[model samples]
Target: MRVLVVEDHEELAETVAAGLRREGMAVDLALDGPTALERAEINGYDVVVLDRDLPGVHGDQVCRTLAAGGSRARVLMLTASGTVADRVAGL
Candidate 1:
Protein backbone atom coordinates (compact mmCIF):
# COMPACT_ATOMS: atom_id res chain seq x y z
CA MET A 1 0.00 0.00 0.00
CA ARG A 2 1.07 3.57 -0.69
CA VAL A 3 1.20 5.82 2.34
CA LEU A 4 1.93 9.46 2.98
CA VAL A 5 3.28 10.46 6.39
CA VAL A 6 2.74 14.14 7.13
CA GLU A 7 4.37 15.62 10.20
CA ASP A 8 6.23 18.74 11.28
CA HIS A 9 8.37 16.75 13.69
CA GLU A 10 11.28 15.61 11.61
CA GLU A 11 12.41 12.75 13.77
CA LEU A 12 8.90 11.47 14.34
CA ALA A 13 8.07 11.66 10.67
CA GLU A 14 11.17 9.74 9.64
CA THR A 15 10.60 7.19 12.35
CA VAL A 16 7.04 6.54 11.27
CA ALA A 17 7.98 6.36 7.61
CA ALA A 18 10.79 3.94 8.39
CA GLY A 19 8.46 1.70 10.34
CA LEU A 20 5.95 1.67 7.52
CA ARG A 21 8.66 0.94 5.01
CA ARG A 22 9.84 -1.95 7.11
CA GLU A 23 6.32 -3.31 6.86
CA GLY A 24 6.84 -3.44 3.06
CA MET A 25 4.66 -0.46 2.31
CA ALA A 26 5.49 2.30 -0.14
CA VAL A 27 5.94 5.41 1.97
CA ASP A 28 6.57 9.12 1.38
CA LEU A 29 7.15 11.93 3.82
CA ALA A 30 5.86 15.50 4.03
CA LEU A 31 7.06 17.80 6.79
CA ASP A 32 4.27 20.33 6.55
CA GLY A 33 0.75 20.80 5.29
CA PRO A 34 1.44 22.53 1.96
CA THR A 35 4.04 19.97 1.04
CA ALA A 36 1.62 17.27 2.04
CA LEU A 37 -1.00 18.67 -0.26
CA GLU A 38 1.46 18.95 -3.11
CA ARG A 39 2.71 15.43 -2.64
CA ALA A 40 -0.82 14.11 -2.42
CA GLU A 41 -1.61 15.85 -5.70
CA ILE A 42 1.45 14.42 -7.41
CA ASN A 43 1.11 10.95 -5.94
CA GLY A 44 -1.83 8.66 -5.45
CA TYR A 45 -1.72 7.47 -1.86
CA ASP A 46 -3.80 4.71 -0.28
CA VAL A 47 -3.53 6.28 3.15
CA VAL A 48 -2.55 9.63 4.62
CA VAL A 49 -1.07 9.59 8.13
CA LEU A 50 -1.70 13.22 8.89
CA ASP A 51 -0.57 15.29 11.84
CA ARG A 52 -3.45 17.39 13.10
CA ASP A 53 -1.18 20.37 13.74
CA LEU A 54 1.05 21.41 10.86
CA PRO A 55 2.98 24.32 9.45
CA GLY A 56 2.44 26.15 6.10
CA VAL A 57 -1.21 25.20 6.42
CA HIS A 58 -3.37 23.76 9.17
CA GLY A 59 -4.08 20.02 9.15
CA ASP A 60 -7.82 20.55 9.35
CA GLN A 61 -7.64 22.73 6.26
CA VAL A 62 -5.48 20.17 4.56
CA CYS A 63 -8.00 17.44 5.23
CA ARG A 64 -10.86 19.60 4.00
CA THR A 65 -9.00 20.56 0.85
CA LEU A 66 -8.18 16.96 0.09
CA ALA A 67 -11.80 15.95 0.51
CA ALA A 68 -13.08 18.90 -1.50
CA GLY A 69 -10.66 18.01 -4.28
CA GLY A 70 -11.93 14.42 -4.35
CA SER A 71 -8.96 12.58 -2.94
CA ARG A 72 -10.11 9.07 -2.13
CA ALA A 73 -7.24 8.22 0.22
CA ARG A 74 -8.29 7.47 3.76
CA VAL A 75 -6.93 9.87 6.38
CA LEU A 76 -5.52 8.62 9.66
CA MET A 77 -5.30 11.73 11.78
CA LEU A 78 -2.77 12.16 14.62
CA THR A 79 -2.33 14.81 17.25
CA ALA A 80 -0.07 15.47 20.22
CA SER A 81 -2.87 17.09 22.11
CA GLY A 82 -4.82 15.14 24.71
CA THR A 83 -7.67 17.64 24.94
CA VAL A 84 -11.18 16.50 24.18
CA ALA A 85 -11.79 19.29 21.67
CA ASP A 86 -8.63 18.51 19.78
CA ARG A 87 -9.49 14.83 19.61
CA VAL A 88 -13.03 15.49 18.45
CA ALA A 89 -11.89 18.13 15.98
CA GLY A 90 -9.59 15.69 14.27
CA LEU A 91 -12.56 13.61 13.24
Candidate 2:
Protein backbone atom coordinates (compact mmCIF):
# COMPACT_ATOMS: atom_id res chain seq x y z
CA MET A 1 0.00 0.00 0.00
CA ARG A 2 1.19 3.51 -0.72
CA VAL A 3 0.44 5.67 2.31
CA LEU A 4 0.77 9.41 2.66
CA VAL A 5 1.31 10.58 6.25
CA VAL A 6 0.39 14.20 6.90
CA GLU A 7 1.59 15.34 10.31
CA ASP A 8 3.26 18.36 11.87
CA HIS A 9 4.84 16.46 14.74
CA GLU A 10 8.11 15.11 13.46
CA GLU A 11 8.58 12.31 15.98
CA LEU A 12 5.08 10.98 15.69
CA ALA A 13 5.18 11.13 11.91
CA GLU A 14 8.50 9.31 11.78
CA THR A 15 7.31 6.65 14.17
CA VAL A 16 4.18 6.05 12.19
CA ALA A 17 6.08 6.02 8.90
CA ALA A 18 8.67 3.60 10.26
CA GLY A 19 6.02 1.24 11.58
CA LEU A 20 4.16 1.34 8.28
CA ARG A 21 7.42 0.78 6.40
CA ARG A 22 8.12 -2.24 8.58
CA GLU A 23 4.73 -3.56 7.59
CA GLY A 24 5.88 -3.42 3.92
CA MET A 25 3.84 -0.42 2.91
CA ALA A 26 5.38 2.49 1.04
CA VAL A 27 5.23 5.65 3.16
CA ASP A 28 5.54 9.35 2.35
CA LEU A 29 5.64 12.14 4.93
CA ALA A 30 4.53 15.78 4.88
CA LEU A 31 5.02 18.09 7.86
CA ASP A 32 2.61 20.84 6.89
CA GLY A 33 -0.78 21.17 5.26
CA PRO A 34 0.26 22.75 1.96
CA THR A 35 2.97 20.19 1.42
CA ALA A 36 0.51 17.48 2.32
CA LEU A 37 -2.00 18.76 -0.17
CA GLU A 38 0.63 19.15 -2.85
CA ARG A 39 1.88 15.63 -2.31
CA ALA A 40 -1.60 14.22 -2.26
CA GLU A 41 -2.53 15.99 -5.47
CA ILE A 42 0.60 14.98 -7.30
CA ASN A 43 0.94 11.39 -6.13
CA GLY A 44 -1.28 8.36 -6.45
CA TYR A 45 -1.57 7.40 -2.81
CA ASP A 46 -3.66 4.45 -1.70
CA VAL A 47 -4.31 5.90 1.77
CA VAL A 48 -3.79 9.19 3.52
CA VAL A 49 -3.07 9.20 7.27
CA LEU A 50 -4.05 12.81 7.86
CA ASP A 51 -3.67 14.85 11.02
CA ARG A 52 -6.77 16.93 11.71
CA ASP A 53 -4.82 19.96 12.90
CA LEU A 54 -1.99 21.13 10.68
CA PRO A 55 -0.16 24.26 9.57
CA GLY A 56 -0.99 26.01 6.22
CA VAL A 57 -4.29 24.14 5.97
CA HIS A 58 -6.28 21.85 8.27
CA GLY A 59 -6.61 18.20 7.49
CA ASP A 60 -10.37 18.46 7.25
CA GLN A 61 -10.06 21.05 4.52
CA VAL A 62 -7.55 18.88 2.77
CA CYS A 63 -9.92 15.94 2.84
CA ARG A 64 -12.79 17.99 1.54
CA THR A 65 -10.67 19.57 -1.17
CA LEU A 66 -9.34 16.22 -2.31
CA ALA A 67 -12.78 14.74 -2.43
CA ALA A 68 -14.05 17.69 -4.39
CA GLY A 69 -11.13 17.38 -6.77
CA GLY A 70 -11.87 13.67 -7.32
CA SER A 71 -8.96 12.07 -5.53
CA ARG A 72 -9.25 8.29 -5.21
CA ALA A 73 -7.20 7.88 -2.02
CA ARG A 74 -8.99 7.04 1.21
CA VAL A 75 -8.39 9.27 4.21
CA LEU A 76 -7.91 8.04 7.77
CA MET A 77 -8.16 11.09 9.98
CA LEU A 78 -5.91 11.17 13.06
CA THR A 79 -6.65 13.85 15.58
CA ALA A 80 -6.14 14.65 19.26
CA SER A 81 -9.38 16.61 19.39
CA GLY A 82 -11.95 13.92 19.91
CA THR A 83 -15.56 15.09 20.08
CA VAL A 84 -18.78 14.69 18.19
CA ALA A 85 -18.69 18.34 17.14
CA ASP A 86 -15.10 18.10 16.02
CA ARG A 87 -15.72 14.99 13.97
CA VAL A 88 -18.80 16.52 12.43
CA ALA A 89 -16.88 19.68 11.65
CA GLY A 90 -14.17 17.60 10.06
CA LEU A 91 -16.67 15.88 7.83
Number of the top-ranking candidate, with TM-score as the measure: 1
lDDT of 1 by residue, 35-89 (tens): 9999999999999999988999999999999999999999999988999988888
Query: Who wins the lDDT comparison?
Result: 1
The lDDT, on a scale of 0 to 1, for candidate 1 is 0.95
Off by over 4 Å in 1: none
Model 1 residue 76 lDDT score: 93
Q: How accurate is candidate 2 locally (lDDT)?
A: 0.93
lDDT of 2 by residue, 36-65 (tens): 989988899999999999999988888998
Which pairs of residues have clashing backbones in candidate 1? none
TM-score: model 1 vs. ground truth: 0.97
TM-scores for every predicted model: 0.97, 0.95
